[model samples]
Target chain A: MHATALAHSNIALVKYWGKRDRALNLPVAGSLSLTLGGLATTTTVHFRPELESDLVSLDGRELRPGSVAHRRIADFLDLVRNDAGITSFAEVETANNFPTAAGLASSASGFAALALAATHAAGQQLTDAQLSVLARRGSGSAARSIFGGFAEMSAGTRADGRDAHARALAGPEHWDLRCVVAVTTQGEKDVSSTEGMTRTQETSPLFEPWARTVDADIAQARHAVETRDFALLGRVAERSCLGMHASAMAADPGVIYWNPTTIEVIHRVRRARRDGLQIFFTIDAGPHVKVFCPARELSALRSVLSQIDGVNDLIVARPGQGAHLLES
Target chain B: MHATALAHSNIALVKYWGKRDRALNLPVAGSLSLTLGGLATTTTVHFRPELESDLVSLDGRELRPGSVAHRRIADFLDLVRNDAGITSFAEVETANNFPTAAGLASSASGFAALALAATHAAGQQLTDAQLSVLARRGSGSAARSIFGGFAEMSAGTRADGRDAHARALAGPEHWDLRCVVAVTTQGEKDVSSTEGMTRTQETSPLFEPWARTVDADIAQARHAVETRDFALLGRVAERSCLGMHASAMAADPGVIYWNPTTIEVIHRVRRARRDGLQIFFTIDAGPHVKVFCPARELSALRSVLSQIDGVNDLIVARPGQGAHLLES
Candidate 1:
């Protein structure tokens, strides 16, 4: 059996930082995000009874069996195999529209798409929430990619994590906001999100406070999303973004994701805000910065950002659709 | 009466951040620091009944009456006058040997020297502990600059901060550590230390946690200083620096003091340490970074830092003497 699916990358307004559970990939706090239309991942999975092991390919190149990428995908696939009650191995091919492992949340979209495709190929019927739960096993952020537009992943209290999954706050048509991404570098980040989060939780003195304070941020963001309050949303979003980075930075052998270009964009955006432009910036676990503003201010944001040095590429995105099977 | 005093800037190993009493300029926690020999401030105070008001000059430029610099000095002079029970206005001239307001702790030296000279010029003889309390009224960090070598400023319990004063941890000759400063920019930081600390205390969620955690860092740094343990000292010093900056960075609108070159130096220094060089770096709320190592590693530290693109200048400093009267 073979099937294909697609999912979009998400930008967290209220970020999910430290995880409560490592093995289950459960978040320590609720997170709010918007799916981006421009950046995406497409995946196809085929289960063959004759295959001795799972074969994984990314961007048209076959992943070697012993490589990290190959092993992670293989391990994720085992969950689908166990659920389907089959010994058969699968050949999985995942393609990202944007750069991989550059802090673009490729794993979010990759695993979400993979969940949909792998489940379909296994001939198993699962609801959206069920798919979200399954996707979370692959990556903590993956659960949010199961829903379009505004989504919130609950930091579930259950030991099994069956109750913790993403829910849609509003669809794409509910808001007309824009995300202008300034990609600063193409190189892979020195530390992965999993590695960074683990360190922050283990060593950062501020991690407990960070975890405690995030719920208020998530609540504020939720209210802003419900009322379409851009200013309120922007304030909470920037605060949340900086708070996460701050906690990570306090860890011993601290995780510093922002490069010089990342900081340049932040300063310029704040300066522009002082000049009366209604915009805010957020950075995930990489050097790139995403500037959030209303649709009408796109040109102004573009003009200001383009003037900055060493910005590799700019991608303008709007709220996009959720993960679904694509007929081939 | 007239007197001249010289004071050297002290860099905190365990930083002093957040204030419990803004009016008294009392720190939320005690801090540990190392006094530097190369950077200093010299001040001469002449009390003249002929002058209508305090005349303040920094370096060669005369400060306007209502100007921030002028008012701060004048207001501080008021404290000395009140203590000495005299109304005579003073002609105050302070000269910084290094860059002013570029995050080099000029205020620490300036205020400490002013406490000594202004008190001496007013014919008030006091102990060093009493001088520290007076210096703290000018600037919180100035309290620590009153003592030489490694000093610890206690976060005193008294509301008036009369009991809160710096005491010498060890004399200058106790440690032979070298601090190689990389001056990244000569420009003044956008947010002053006082303003940034206030913002962090008022708005940052992590501020409370940061304040709570600093005492342990101080204790560790103090222990390291006592035993001359470089590795332990380095660990806590870097953590304290980043933790303080992190708390500031999490504030609403965030008080980010780092420039592009600041981050570059940090990354390069961390990378070089992987090559087996025993060194650590710390930053005050400005663009410059100080690389700390043994005296023998000064050349190696210089060579590495000089190769950085935007490092403007490098100053090698050892432990320095405390504030003392300069014969004129």
Candidate 2:
């Protein structure tokens, strides 16, 4: 019997936008993210020799039997099997603790967790980097979600994307960084990351400057993390989020990701900047803003952010653990 | 007798966005532009001994004696008089055939014409380089506009900015390029180039990539003009415009110069790409699209572009001649 297995994917403060080498899923800039324990995905893998083809079901709903994600898993299985000289058909059942394909990199973290479970189900063990490369084939950001604490997805140099992998920069104890996920809109994300990135690459003039900042932020962030410099962390985080949004304005039929209330919340936080408040915000493909505040100021920041008109719910998240499995 | 002075200013396709060293007005990127005959400014300078102070007028309206533009002229007079060993205040009068301060780089042509007339009035024989450097103090883009045809404003390495001067790459008649200017909106620009470029230099993510694109476009545009290759000209011009817009997107309150009509015109032109039509569009600080079409396709493109809604007016322009004073 196969028991259910789950994992968490974190949101990046430094965004992953363009591909340096698309074939290897290598990004143009290195990205940093914080993993959260509260938000995660549970995946179960079942392998049977009797099954004719691979199938994937998410949250009790079977997806188009062989979609892009499904093919990715099948391909991974084929590779691992070939290396191990074993042949088999497998079924992957994955469900999110959050939402699937909902603009959150749930798929990134979801597929990454699935990769772990499926590979384990085949009785094969691999290093984290090796696992990340396998997961990146599913989604570029997923590879970064495999590690906890402060993580950096090195933009690989090789044309094949072999050097591209996520590495842990600092552990959770280094800084008391706290994130509050304010769920603004839970509806289908209007823009897909795939289309959004492509539009940004083709149209946004800000993309290059955004890339340069990532490098600068990486160095500054590392020092900030090492020295526990909350001010530096807040500044870098705020600037990175602002840089990503700037690219949004240059997209064809340009639209900002912020809802009316999301903007209001950001403003309130900005207003609090004068008080040396450590509150900063970053958003991905969705309208929600992941407000990063020091745990010491969590109560104060939460009170103000919660009062924002459109914020649906606020969840306080601390540092999360790396990938793991459930024992049967 | 009123002297008729018709002077045209060139527009840099690779814009002179930011001043790297502000005191020197040193730009970060070299820019290229075309002077147009249909759109220009005409000015006449006359010294009046009756007025205790210098008086300036535009069209038929008398401006404040202490106006900033008047002050600039006074300052220029101080420099010239000190350099030439002469002292006298002169009255300056100017008028434009096009809209003033409507984000059209009016000063580019305006100041160029004014500089030429003022020089003649002062009885100072000046070289084109001296005239260009003088015009630049009035407006950076104006320096380039002083020359006709393909021109570039070099971002000088010297601190004094003496090295920064516009040079003609080719005269207007070097290539039979047809331009179609589609007016999308007529109003004061929300962001001035000074404020906008400062923001871009400080915060734009696309700045570095934009700088690289400038270099590439300058080289390619010069080649296209020399070779009279319409395809290459269209390609480089469009890329340069897009690159310029990219910086705008990265601003804190990111906004491009495009209105809805501007978008429509660009899309229609792109859709027509499959028709083997040689066409490209460039926009500056206004919501207008300057389409670079081959001479043979000008009427056809104008006909198609005119059909788009919200377009206020469409004007056809040809390669322009250098600045000259028209005697009456």
Candidate 3:
């Protein structure tokens, strides 16, 4: 049975940037993400006895035999075989509904889709927690990608890392929150998380302060989401982002990702906030900005942004679902 | 008089990336900076009614009649006039040892020196606290420049921000910690702290997490300094930088400033750490990386770093002192 598996990348209200354990892929703290409807990856897996190696393709591009992505898949298979007694060469094909490498947590979605598809292909049933652990081995945020809607990956106080897994905080329909992504560029990241987090951990003096500070936001954000306090959610998310960047500056060579246009849209939003316009914003990875506002404010926010200099394109999105089997 | 007045730019560890109180020039968070040893503007202030207008020169260059620095000086004069019950602009000539507009906090140090000089020129007997408040109005981190050694500006809870001010954490002798600065590029910042912090505040979702996380590090860092635990201090500082960058990723147009070479040095540090090397790194607003190894390990760390791919220049700095008037 080769059922297509589809998974959505959750946009973190409280984002994850660094790691506590790079090997285990454990995070420094808990984070909350909204599963977005517009951004997702779908994959299909099938095992063939005739094939000697596992095959992976993304968006119709056949991966090179020893590419990082393919290696990741093969290595993951090795782990699963050693740990879960799965011994099969699987051919896997994956596709993204949204733009790849656009700072949209494609790896989170990609790995989650692969994990679900491959596990199902093996004819073995696994719990969501088990699936999450498997996904985390690939990317720390991928653990959270196994679930949909409002989810939290608890930074449990254990080296075993079993404590760090995703749990649904609220369903997709809990609140009518809208996210408008201002997509700037889609290029390969200069520093991959595997390496970036390691450098930050070793070099950044500001890292410890940032690690301990976000817990309150995590609690507050969850509470805000539960109560449908959209304003609180937006405000807290923005605060969390600032705190994270403060640590970045404290790193040995302080880093900033904002271009001139990024600055303009931010001010436009701030001006809106000052003028009592209802919307809040957050950013992740690339130069793109994601604004969390009510659906009603979309037109006004867009109008304001359109008038501003340097803002490129805005993709409107709402809460999305988790990894699922799609009938071909 | 102006003989005792010293000006220093307030540099943010938490950095005032943005300005919430634009008119007051209040930063989002308190920053820490070292008052340079060589360059300081010393002026003996005496209110003279005979002068038609205030005379101002920066490093032998006379300021035009209506420049911003001139306007700022004028504004400072007016403020001191109202606060200290004094009037009349005194002639001010300031010289900076460092290059102007080189992203070296020259304006901060310059204005701080100018404030000190002006206040002394005005014959105002202001306390360090009062002077800090005055300095903060000029530039957020300048308030901390009033004191030497490790400084911390209280991120006060007061809404009026009257309680927010800089305090000395320790004297230079607290730790033998050495900071080796590698200057990557000498240029003007594309975005100032006022613009950067504001963008972070308004746009980055990761900012809040960063804000929440640093408190623990602040406490630990202070304690580490008190205890003189170099390893702990380095660890705390490194983490702080990571948290800051995490928020940058959450910004609308996210960024990681490390070029391939920068990344290589960081990776080298991590590799060394994994191999049981004891060197720490931290970064600020620039592309350069600062290593915080002890003076004992300085030679070894530097030699190892020299072999790395993208390092340009390395300047070693010890604990610097507060701004002082240099003898002509």
What TM value does chain A in model 2 reach?
Answer: 0.91
Task: Please state the error at residue B290 of candidate 3 in Å.
Answer: 17
On lDDT, the candidate that comes out on top is 1
Per-candidate RMSD vs. true structure? Answer: 1.7, 6.4, 9.6
User: Model 1 off-target regions past 4 Å?
Assistant: A186-188, B186-188
Error of 1 at B56 (Å): 2.1
**TM-score (0 to 1) of chain B for each candidate:** 0.97, 0.91, 0.84
Residue runs of model 3 more than 4 Å from their true location after superposition:
A185-189, B1-328
The digit string of per-residue lDDT tens for model 1 on A1-328 reads 8999999989899999988878888888889999988779999999998888998899999999989989889988899989998779998988998878556789899999999999999999899999999999998888999999999999889999997899999998899989998988543258878899999999998888888888899899999999999989999999989999999999997888877677778889988998999899999988899999999999999999999887878889999899988986
1 versus 3: better lDDT goes to: 1
Q: Which structure among the candidates has the greatest TM-score?
A: 1
Candidate 2 local accuracy as lDDT?
0.72
Q: lDDT ranking from best to worst? A: 1, 2, 3
DockQ of predicted model 1: 0.68
User: Order of all candidates by TM-score, from best down to worst?
Assistant: 1, 2, 3
lDDT of 3 by residue, B1-328 (tens): 3443555433334333445467776655554433333434454445677777777777788888689788877677777778767666667777665555434566666656656666665666667676767776766766777766677776565666666777788866666656665555432234554455666667665576566655666777777778878777767666666565555544644443443344446556666765766787666555567677776877878777777644766666666566555442
Model no. 3, DockQ: 0.11
Q: lDDT tens string, model 2, A124-163? A: 7879897777777667877876787777788877777777
